[model samples]
Target chain A: MRHSGYQIWLLTLSLAAATLGAIVYATGMGHIAVPASEIIRVIAARVTSNPALLAGIDPVFPFVVFDVRLPRILTSTLVGGGLAMSGVIYQGILLNPLADPYTLGVSSGAAFGAALALLANLTMMGHFSVPLFAFGGAALTLLVVLYLSSFNGQISANTLILSGVIVGAILAAGISFLKYLADEQVAVIIFWLMGSFASRTWLDVTVVAMAVVFGLGLSFFYARDLNILSLGSRSADTLGVESGRVRWILLLGASLVTAVCVSVSGIIGFIGLIVPHLMRFLVGPDNRKLLPVSILAGALLLLVADTVTRAVLPVEVPIGVLTALIGGPFFCVIFRKRQRRVA
Target chain B: MSATSGFGLSGVSFDYGTTPALVDLDLCLPPGKFYGIVGPNGCGKTTFLDMLTGSKSPDRGSVTFMDRPVAEYRRRDLARLVALVPQDFGIDFAYTVQEVVLMGRHPYIGRFASPGAEDWRQVDAAMAAIGISHFKDRFVNELSGGEKQRVVVARALAQQTQFLLFDEATSSLDVQYTMQIFNVARNLVRGEGRTVIAVIHNLNLAAAYCDEIIFMQAGKVVACGPSDSVLESSMIKKVFGVESRVEVDDFSKTKQISFRYWS
Candidate 1:
């Protein structure tokens, strides 16, 4: 069984690699028509071996492949991977497979924060302030949820969910207040609300990259605790897990990862909820393998969605819309199958 | 505290906030004996198990395992010695039985070190021992209640600890499966010399399976001794408020409680 698992994982990796490469090459082909050869040349040049060839290549091809397409692709990859990983961690921690960034209200809180900052012209100083305040909002909302959920020290699952819903409602109300106060830029505010990866740069990608890497690192360390937690908190404690401490750390880490991803790319939904479920079906529920696999699958899925949105229509479709379109049906299929199994 | 104190509870007590769950409880179990705790619901059976397993710290005193205060042992070290098989588990993810069993090896795994061939061998052996080798690759969440309970026991076995605690591991199981599990536990104690402690509800089941029985009522131990001695008709009536006939099984020399009250 174990050997079969390794073989299956290797197979998954190969499939993911192929899918990722195809999406990149195909997506790079459209609009700009950067040839496959040029794409490869630029990639190879960027990596090593032949800088002179890369330098000799047309600056337009290099610019299109490296600067424009790569950042966008990388952004989708980071955000998708981060969201999926966060989803896995949250599900394990909560013992609820339905949990995701949105369930915890981190997305709504960050969106409200980003909207507040953007609409109020707080970003007038710089674009970085938007993400900074968005992260702050996410963290603050998490603190509020944690505080509200704790009943004399123990955090019940019901209380946690209820707290998140309440906090999310409050944040949404705040966003509406901002919307009402705004005289113009309602379009930009609405765009932010709907979600987008429209304007990504290397810096945005770097910020998301750091958050994902850091969150994934924290998750790996807590993965064992998470497995114990899945047994239920009392049992987890019997297994010598510091249940409360581990929970707080994981919840905070997952929320932080979600906030950073949303701040950079705007609330990309469904990837978090769907990617982990798909990965769990493929790999067993062990977080050790589930997390990394979900990250890869999520990146691939979101990249495909974004690529399709860009290619399917002349007008740019918000990446969020495309994800929900694909994710919603996929989610229904899973839910239906689960209902049948339960029945 | 001696080097061989397997488990010791000194004046331990617990409360569900204001309501007391356990009061002035004291227990000492040497490392290598099969022991049983028998009680009804709301009698603190689960709470006692929680205290013994470090899930709930005592409100007053402390529990010591292996000569070290349980609180002093790091979570990892505590797991190496004591393994718990909880009554029920909720699994959201569909981990295969083998994978679930392999997680018992978590404490032993070093950083960046994946489970090697030997670890898989141990897991396979555990699965085979529990008669669930056929279900090694099957999703755990998909298993029936009895099968899932066995898988949990197999996980505890894979932990390879000297001390194993079962919190009513077989309550939901059918008669044959329950007997099969207890037989396994008996073998672990008699054949392998491992210490086993179980919180069992059915007095007849405990009488048949346990070598020694501790009867609890109202957060305290009412009677404790060899199964026959602790499982008397008087003690059963006193603790459970139910009249019962106690008969000695000739083959096993165990006292079996037969309830007379229908209503």
Candidate 2:
């Protein structure tokens, strides 16, 4: 039976409210220790075009909220939402519950590209060069995977996945070799591979925002077709999905989403894999509902992870490790719970 | 054949890497009748069904429906006219029976549009017709093979198409499910003027239900006519290399075949 529209709307509204709350709550928890009220005041002062609200607040408040914390917070949140969105698309189009952005080796390809940039010292373009190379690597990997998997004008989902693993494995080796070439720069490459939100500026936020928003907009347009697709390609095609074309578009589209997310934040893990499954349990399997809700839930999850590591922990850990360390156990608990229910 | 009422394939052929799957095959399928195509394995029955449904195009000839080239219809447009029930009912997600059936209305619903009440009505009516209304709330994985097959049929029915194609849809089911699916199709053909073409492996099931049967061998049709006329022992022996006895079943008054020996 269909999920209640009223309930779905309420759930979505709650998530939206919670995500907004998460941003506010996380912004205040950093070392500078801006209170939640001051955090809101800083934002309110900026939006209302009144500098009076900033008076008597610690002079560091505006700088910390706007320059120090918010960008990192926003970037991580958007990247999380973006990764989850790509996860939803990949799982839906490939018709495999196991599929995610990394399932197709997109992250490996991006890391290899970023590694090459770091090794070669391609700093003339400055911060832009690494992400540019990363996008190139991801787009190229997608094309290669499609080429290797396609047969008689159709890309079999199994072949595509298998080919992704093969190509990803080779790229992983390439990244390792690049690490050796980097010598002293190996530290930077390793840090990048571990993934973080440190020192991210508004530029990174803008880049991820544009890509995720445009790609997700396109995905929502095809949301209904994606729903039909989980029934398998033949049924989807017979139901008027133009399954081949839709799959290709959504595959490349999801890859593009992954490309941007990796470019901004390096390879933050598990948000993609964990969010969709969790959201499916809550929202039912409808992509229309799942995609939007997963977007919010992913943002909240990643923001919390970023906050705990950046502030709550005594020593800063890579956000990627935090996600995996945190998300892995959560995923297992949920998976076990589901299995028991099934049994 | 009338200009606008039957499927016509003339001089059609297909090959899989130079191995011919179909060769210069010609067929005319009249609307409003239930037809079955049966043959030994590798006789291209599935391929023929594929071409009829526009899933595959012939290499050397054209297939037309209702006097229009099958290729000319847009995917969504053709979907309104033809729906296929694939043999595999495999789905990765654990959507409910209603969710699965509602997908049949995808062609009618626009992008960014959820299933409206009318679409839900069609889904409900289709499920009821297939006798699956009671299972509407159950997850599809919880269903029995026969119940799942009915859900599949309900999805096809919800497509609201003019032509229904079944590609070994009941191949994995037992005798009961086979008859159950066939009975559903039979009602569509008899009660409504809808056309159905099923590629079946069971000769007895084909003989019992199909109004007209086509017998194929080596990608070429060896017999095509009324079931009673074409399903005799001589054609069965010639095409299947099997000696068999064909007689009407007293219970259903339909042709029943009893196999003797393989040649």
Candidate 3:
């Protein structure tokens, strides 16, 4: 059946809003015994009932709900959206369905840079120095990969994937070297690698929000280019798309956002690789529609995953463990479905 | 037939690594003409077409359109005049026919502006002109090979370019679909004054449809001019190493070449 463009946008907006609300509510219910009413009460008191009611309430309840859970939930929404949008751009630009932020080696480079910053005392100078270093590292690594792949004149998908694999290995080696230098600092590196959202504050929220907003804004700006690139590079160029320019811009943009997210929350995996693919299955691959919807879906999935990681057991499970546990089977199911379709 | 020349290549040559692809290639295409290029594998037929559409730059000499070097033109400005139809059409998305056609209007769109009503009307007209309007809402990826070829041609037409290059565009199509595609190309040239340069492997089909033929051998133009001059039995044997019989059927008044042996 034919669907008007307006109808699709409207439907997407509703879905995103509904998912946003659900993430907020569910994350509020995690890591504590707060009922839904109490969660709402804590939020309402902070917003509407002013400082008087806030003063009378148990400081711990308000602190857990408003201070702790709220920032963590907001950070997850922004990071998830950023990662998914990055996946969409990478897949479209590279013209490969398997392309994602990590596949391009952005995450490994960021991990190396974060490790370097921690071991080198770079963050001792400024609060946001580590995240800044990570962002710069990701952008630089992507630029190098893009340059190397385009060396023979045309940037083929295979070339990008091959370069990404090579560069990722190199960055992983660098991270290991850093890990070995400071034996006691191994705990910090391991925690970062396993991925967590354990200690988020409003300051972390602000930095992540800034990066995600910039990333999504750039995604929308190049949404049309992404759609054209999906038609294949030759067709894209024939249709007046400067393929190289679009590719460089998108890779750097996505890498920057992903680096910031990883730097702040550690190396949360699977959301970038899975959320965009799931959104593509549901809504097809028009970047105009796929991008915004994926953003919402990613946030929703990550938030739910984050809540489960916290609430499923007395001890908090690392976010990476939960995502890996869910992502492997989920990817297998998608692969089997794809195989059936191809057959 | 028309006053304007769609493309002109002069003193052009190219090489891939150490092997020469095109050596001092020269060709001129007038507007509203159907030019078919035929050659064996690795004969540089596709390379010639790519140079004309600005996909690959010539190593020496120049390609010009309307007296301007092709490279000097802005990307969108070049697209406004010429469109290329590559042989392979693989898309990961499930965009409907209308949506794919609308993509051809990318050059006309402004930043953040959606396609206006007239733009969609043009998309509909292009689809209707190609007789695929019935599949407007059907997913493009689900179409048969022939249908996909037609849809892609329709997209090129929607670009509103004056010249189109078809790089072995019909290799994957069936017999009936191949002729249908040729008929569409014929209409675009005859009715709309659009110039078309197509790389075709089927000599008989080219004989029946093309106004001019250029035959390449090992990256050089061995023969070019009228279709009758280029499709001679001797040239076919020399370029393709196939013993072939050439005959002109009286009913169709077309030269047909049929290959019989490798020698």
Candidate 4:
């Protein structure tokens, strides 16, 4: 069904407001529980450049809100948004409902890069080295997959998916080998692989935020063309959509978003897969409407997951483990329902 | 047909890897008439339509629409002048029928702009013309095959191009809708002076609606002319390897062919 522009705008606005509310609420729930008012006050002060707003709060409150909670919260939110946006693009470009950001093997590539960095103990770039390497690995993997899939300047969905699976398997094996090489440090490597937002800093947040914003803008700009692309390449060509050019641009753009997100947060799965499907259920399949709503929903989902793991759980489970535990069952439900409907 | 005024192909050839789809050939199709291409499977009928729409460029020679090389026109410009209804449209997404039809305006709509009121009006008119206005709000995937084919036809109509190519577009529709759609195409050709080229599977239907007929066999045009001249029994036997009785239908005043197996 077609959603009116007003309805989509209203839905997007509500989602944006809810994400902000969740961020503020989540920021206040940690060990040293600051009130929501103080969280808002600290954020307000930071935004307004006014020290006067910090008068009555405990000195530790500002430090915890800014240095401890907010960075991790924002990073998880942006990463979630980025992954979800990527999922929408990947699914649309591939024209497969089952496709996700990881369908391109971007996460496996990023994981392989991070594992290599950890095994080698490279610290030349300090906290940025691993993420930088991971991004590089993802970029290279995307190039390889694109190269393998393209035949006479045309890339079919089946070939692209096949190439991704083959490349991803190779990378998965390479990561396993890196784990074997880590020996005593395998626990650290494993922990990173499990994924977390435990110690994310402002730098991580900024990187993800930039990538998500740019990616969202580009995706939205091409959302109409993406919708036409679902009609298949020949129809899209007849409708004047440069199917080859637009498909690859969207593939590269979405892979870039996935790369940055996975590099920052390790292998966070299912958000990219689930968020688009969930939002499509709500907003219909028009990518123009789906892109913004999916991004916000993704950000909200990841932030809530991070908050639950960080505060509500008795012990801190890795965020990735928590998401997979929840999302795997959730995905099965969606898949089963779709199968029943088709039957 | 005047070569300078209509779609003209000279020494055109295209191949699928090592296999030839369209051999080196020359053909000219004039505007403002319905032309039907009939051939057995894998006879390059669909490939010919692809060439006219510029979806596939010929490996040799030139294809021109209105005396301009089809390759020289921008993709959008070509789309503005020509539209196609493919045989198989495999869309599994849940876009409403109106939304699908509205996508025909993509070539005219700006990259960042939304579909204007004019675009919606064209969509509504096209849907109405194709008798699918009632199901405008229905999800395309939920519709029956015939309904979905109507929606696709409506989309091409909404494109409002002078040249329309149908690649076995009515294969899924029932006889009633198929005849209705052909009547609509005939009206587009007669009243609006548009050009239509349909790769038809049914010989009688093509003979009834098409102003001209082109028969292809083994990647070559075996016959091309009016239905009375080109659509004879021998040509049908030669192309399809079947014996047929060609008779003039008293009701429709058109040639009708009935096929028979070799005894």
Model 3 chain B: worst 10 consecutive residues (lDDT sum): B1-10
lDDT of 4 by residue, A1-343 (tens): 3457788899999999999999999999978999999998998999999989999999999899999999999999999999899889888877767567576778888788877876788899987677777777887888898789888656665577689889989998898888898898988777878889988889989888888888988898889999999998899989998887898788778877787788778888889889998888788998988998999999999999999999998999998898878777876786677667667
Q: What is the C-alpha lDDT of each candidate?
A: 0.80, 0.84, 0.81, 0.88
Q: What would the TM-scores of all predictions be? A: 0.89, 0.92, 0.90, 0.93
Model 1 per-residue lDDT tens digits across residues A121-165: 785547577777777788788788768987755557656767877
Candidate 3, B1-263: lDDT as tens digits? 33545678899999988889999988877788899998999889878877887878999989988878999988888888888888888876678888888888888888599999878888988898778999888898788877888888888888888888999888888887788778888988899888889999898988999999898888888888988777789988888878888999887789987778544
TM-score of chain A, every prediction, order shown: 0.86, 0.89, 0.88, 0.89
Candidate 3 lDDT, A319-339, residue by residue in tens: 877776877677567657655
Q: Which residue pairs collide, candidate 4?
A: none
Best by TM-score: 4
Best of the two (1, 3) by TM-score: 3
For each candidate, the DockQ is 0.55, 0.72, 0.66, 0.75
Name the lDDT value of residue B36 in candidate 4: 97
Expressed as tens digits, the lDDT of each residue in B88-186 for candidate 4 is 877768899999999999999998887899999999999999999998988988988889899999999999899999999999999999998999999
In order, the interface RMSDs are 1.7, 1.1, 1.2, 0.8
| Candidate 3, superposed: residue stretches over 4 Å from native | A1-7, A23-27, A30-55, A60-67, A124-128, A136-170, A339-343, B1-5
RMSD of each predicted structure: 3.5, 3.0, 3.3, 2.7
lDDT tens digits by residue: candidate 1, B1-263 = 24367888889898888989899988877766678898778889888887777777898988888877888878878888888999886675777888788878777776568888877787888888788998787888888888889998888888888889999999778988788788988888898888899998887888887888888888998777778677788888888888898998787677767788786
List where candidate 1 sits over 4 angstroms from the true fold: A1-3, A19-30, A40-67, A119-129, A139-170, A339-343, B1-4
Which residue runs of candidate 4 sit more than 4 Å off their true CA positions?
Answer: A1-5, A117-136, A139-167, A338-343, B1-3
